[model samples]
Every structure is written in C-alpha cells, then in structure tokens.
Target: MGAVAKKELKQYFHSPVAYVCIGVLMALFGFFYTQVLISGSSSNISYVYSNMFVWCMLVIPILTMRTLSEERRNKTDQALLTAPVSTMGIAGGKFVGAFSIYGLAMTMSLIPAVVLSFVGKPNWGMIFGEYLGALFFGMAMTAIGIFVSSLTENPVIAAIGSLGIAIFLMVIDSVSSAVNNPVLSKVVSWISFSTRYQQFTSGTFDISSVVFFLSVTVAMLFLTSRRLESRRWN
Candidate 1:
C-alpha cells in the first residue's frame, strides 16, 4: 500500500496534470469569491457553496478522468493486477493521491476566509464548518470519479461519467424540493447529496452530514476496488 501510494502521489505531482487541475480550481474559486465580495452579501455562503458545487461538476472530472482509465489505456493495469498488491491497496493508493490534492485545494480555499477576517470579523466557526463540509464532499466526489475511472479506458468517457454523477447529485437537492409528496420528498432530501452540504453554511455542524459524506466515499471506493478486481478475470 505504501509503495502504491508513493507511486500514485508521485504520478500526481510529477505529471503536469495535477498542477493544472489545482490551478484551474483555484482560479475558479478566485473568480467566484470575487463575485461574492462584489455582490455585497453578508453572512451567507450558502449561495456561494451551492454554485461552488457546480464548479466541481467541471473540475473533478479533470482530476479523476485519468486515474484508473489511463492505466488501462496504456496497459499498465496489467502490472497492477498481477502485482502482489491487493485490489484494496491499488484503490487506496489512487484515493489517497486524489484526496491529498483535494486536501490541498481545501486548504487553499481558506485563503479567502483569512482575508475576510481582516475585512470584517467573519463568522470563524461557520467558515470553518463550511471548509469541513467542502473537504468531505470533495472526498466523496473524488471517490465517485475514481469509481467511474475504473470502468473505462477512455479518459474522456471517465471524466464525462464522473461529471454526470456529480451533477446528478448536485441537482438532487432541487429535485427533492420540487417533488409533490411530502414524505417522499423528505426521504429524497435525506439522499440528496447537496442537501447534506447545507448544514455547513448554516453552521449546524451536524454529525449526520459528516457521516453521510464518509459513507458515500467508503461505498464508492469499495466499488472501485471490486471493479479493479473484476479486471483480473477479464
């Protein structure tokens, strides 16, 4: 696991792709933060966060598109499959690589909060909670992207697949809200990934929200491992 993790992390930083992804995300965040600042909003990042999720729809696919798909495309996966490494190790390595960069992205996101602090005493607790929520949600999104990357050799297809799933989850909040049946809508809201993100901006710090993000991440990573294992038989 350590070896795979090292190799994966190296691949992430050594290649120009990882830096490009990070650059794009930071640039987009800068753009959006400017929008927020210029709009003269107060005590409400819910709007920013809601739109930020849409940005993920574009950025996540870039980071995840090549994860496993590139290996298969280049036939490098043959070595990984035959290696003594467990399927879990391979998946774990990839997740760690992606998650590490995501952590970087999240930490970078704090720059605005720090700046805003000097501008006026922003709600530190709420901002921290929002960053926490963004980190967890980013993990889930990357896991889902890795899962899709496992299914195809085409990087473009993997990216498109990841984008579709991320966008679907993002829209579910609205879907739940629009539904007619109250009970069904309530249940749907529970499942709607974006809905869980609301607690952060609202400063709820709900444990259930954290659990839901982690749960999705675990389930998706497990599926990714199984998918890789299936390639052994193929």
Candidate 2:
C-alpha cells in the first residue's frame, strides 16, 4: 500500500495535477484570509475555514480523476491487478495519495491562522476543530472521487461525475429542508455532508460527525475496491 501510494504521489507531482491543485487551494485560502483581515471581521479563522467546502469541491476531482481511470484507459491497470496487491489496498493507496496533497494544502492553511495569532488572539480550539473537520470532509470527498474514477476509463468523465456528486451533496442540506415528507427529509439530512461539517466549526469535538465522514469514506472505498475486483475477474 505504501509503495502504491508513493507511486500515485510521484505521478501527481510528475504531472501538473499536484501543482495546480495545491496552488489553487493556497491561492483561494490566501484570498479569503485577506478578505477577512481587510474587513476586520471576526478574529476567528473559522470563517476562512468555513469557505473550504467550495475549494474541495473544485480541486478534489482533478486530483483523483486520473487515479484509476487513466490506468485503465492506458491498459496499465491489468498490470497492477496482476501484482501482489489487493484491490482494497489499491483503492486505499489511491485515496491516501490524493488526500495527502489535499492535506498538505490544508496544513498550509494554518500559516494564516498562525499569522493571525501574532496580531490578535485567535481561538486555537475552534481553529483546530475546523482544521480537523476539513480533513475529514476532504477524506470523504477523495473517496467519492476515487469511486467515480473506478467506474470509467475516461478521466474527464470521472471528473465530471465526481463534481456532479459533490455538487449534489453540497445542496443536499437545502433539499432536505424543502422536502415535505418527514421520513425522507430526515434521511436526506442524515446523509447531508455539509450539515455535518458545519458542526465542527463551532469549536466542539463531534465524534458522531467524524464517524459519519469515516463511514462514508470507508463505504466509498469498499465500493471502489469491488469495482476493481469485478474488472480483475472479467
């Protein structure tokens, strides 16, 4: 798994994907941080963190689109499958590789918060919660992107499919509220990623929300592994 993950990370850096994704995330983070500073808004950096969902929705697909789809398109996935590695290992490795790049970008976000601490006392606890929440959210999004990538050989299609799903999840909170059926609304709310993510921005450690993100991530990776297994047999 480590070898696979290293290979994926190497592939990302060798191409433009890693640079572009990380650059975009940093640029956006800086922009938001600047806005917050200029506006003299709340000293809490959670405000900047709250806007990260949009950034994840934009970059995660690009980071993961080629993970499996391009290998299959190039007829290289057969080699991987024939090697001494399980399908779940491959999926997990891919997820880790993509998530690492995102994690690095998120880590860099701390610089702004650190800088904020110099001028004004920032809420480290809330900042910590927001950071942790963002990583969990990114983990789930990366898994979803990998699963979408596993379903197609076309990288563009995989990216589009992942983006579509991300957008759907983003709006699901509003959809849940608008639903008339009580049971259906409850179910939709349960699955709404954005709603759960917001729970952490308040500086509280919510174990259930963390578990929900992990559960979704594991389920998506399992489905991706099953897809790979099917392809191996066929």
Candidate 3:
C-alpha cells in the first residue's frame, strides 16, 4: 500500500497537472482570503471555508480523475491487480495519495486564517472545527472520485462523472425540498453534504457528522476495491 501511495504521489509531482491544480486552488483561496479579511474586515473565517467547499467540487474531480483510469488506459491495471497487494490496499493507497495533496492544498489555504488570528480574536475552536470538517469533506469527495475513476478507463469521463456526483451532493438540499414526501425529504437531506458540514461551520463538533463523512469515504473505497476485484476475474 505504501509503495502504491508513493508511486501515486510521485506521479502527481512529476506531472504538470498537480502544479496546475495547486496553483488554481491557491488563487481561489487568495481571492477569498483577501476579500474576507482585507476588504470586509471580518474575523469570521467560515466564509472562506464555505467557498473552499464549493471549489472542492471542481478541484477534487481533477485530482482523482486519473487515479485508476490512467492505469486502465495505459493497460497497467492488470499488473496492479495481479500484484501481491490486496485490492483494498491499492484503493486505500490511491485515496491517501490523492487526499495528501488535498490536505496540502487545504493547509496552504489556511495561511490567511493564521494571518487573521493576529488581527482579531477569532474563535479558535470554531476554526479548528471548520478545518476538521474540510478534511473530512475532502476525504469523502476524493473517495467518490476514486470510485468514479474505477468505473471508466477514460480520465475525461471519470472527471465528468465525478463532477456530476459532487454537484449532486452539493445541491442535494435543494433537491430534497422539491420532494413532496416529508420522510423521503428528511432522508435525502440527511445524506446531503451541506447538511453535515453546516454543523462544523456553525462551531459545533457533531460526532454524527464526522461518522457520516467517514462512512461515505469508507463505503466509496470499498466499492472501488470491489470494482477492481471484478475486473481481475474478467
């Protein structure tokens, strides 16, 4: 698993894609950071976090689009499958690699938060909760992208499919409101990413929200491993 993770990380660094993605993420973060801190004179960092969540909808798909898809495209997936490593290890390794980059990007984005701390007495607890939520959110989104990458050999298709799923999750609250059945609507809202994330942004460390994000990450990784295993048999 470590080997696979190292390879994935190395691949990312060796390619231009990683740099481009990081550049875009930093640019977006800078925009929000400046607008919220400098222009608005607000000590609240939640706005920056909320905007990052939306940006993740696009960044994550680009990051994970080629994880498994590129392997299949290059006819290297067979070698990976036949290796001694378990399917779950490969999936987990890929997820960790992609998530490592996501975490790095998030850390870079937090520089503005650190700067803000010097200017005003922001709630440190709330900031911590927001960062935790962002980490969990990135993990779940990366897992979803990995699963989508497993479904297609074409990276473009994987990216588009992952983006579609991310958008769906982001807008799930609106979709739930259109449902007439109260029970069904409640159920739908329960699974919405925003519903869970709102707790953290509001300075609440809800255990249920943490579990929900972890469950999504684990379930998606499990599904990805199963998909690879099925291909091994075929």
Model 1 root-mean-square deviation = 1.9
For 56-86, candidate 3 gives per-residue lDDT tens digits of: 7789999999999999999999999999999
Evaluation by TM-score, superior candidate among 1 and 3: 3
Residue 65's lDDT in candidate 1: 88
- Give Cα distance to truth, residue 5, candidate 3, Å: 0.3
Across 91-163, the per-residue lDDT of candidate 1 in tens digits comes to 9889888888877987887787567556556667777887788888888888999999999999999999988
- Total clashing pairs in model 3: 0
Lowest summed-lDDT stretch of 10 residues in model 3? 36-45
Instruction: Provide the lowest-lDDT 10-residue window in model 2.
Output: 38-47
TM-score of each: 0.91, 0.96, 0.96
Candidate numbers sorted by lDDT from highest down: 3, 2, 1
- Model 3 vs. true fold: TM: 0.96
After TM-score superposition, the amount by which residue 100's alpha carbon in candidate 2 deviates from its true location, in angstroms, is 0.7
Candidate 1: 10-residue stretch with minimal lDDT: 41-50
lDDT string, candidate 2, 95-163, tens digits: 989999999999998898788777777788888888899999899999999999999999999999999
Q: Report the error of model 2 at residue 42, Å.
A: 4.7
CA lDDT, candidate 2, residue 14:
99
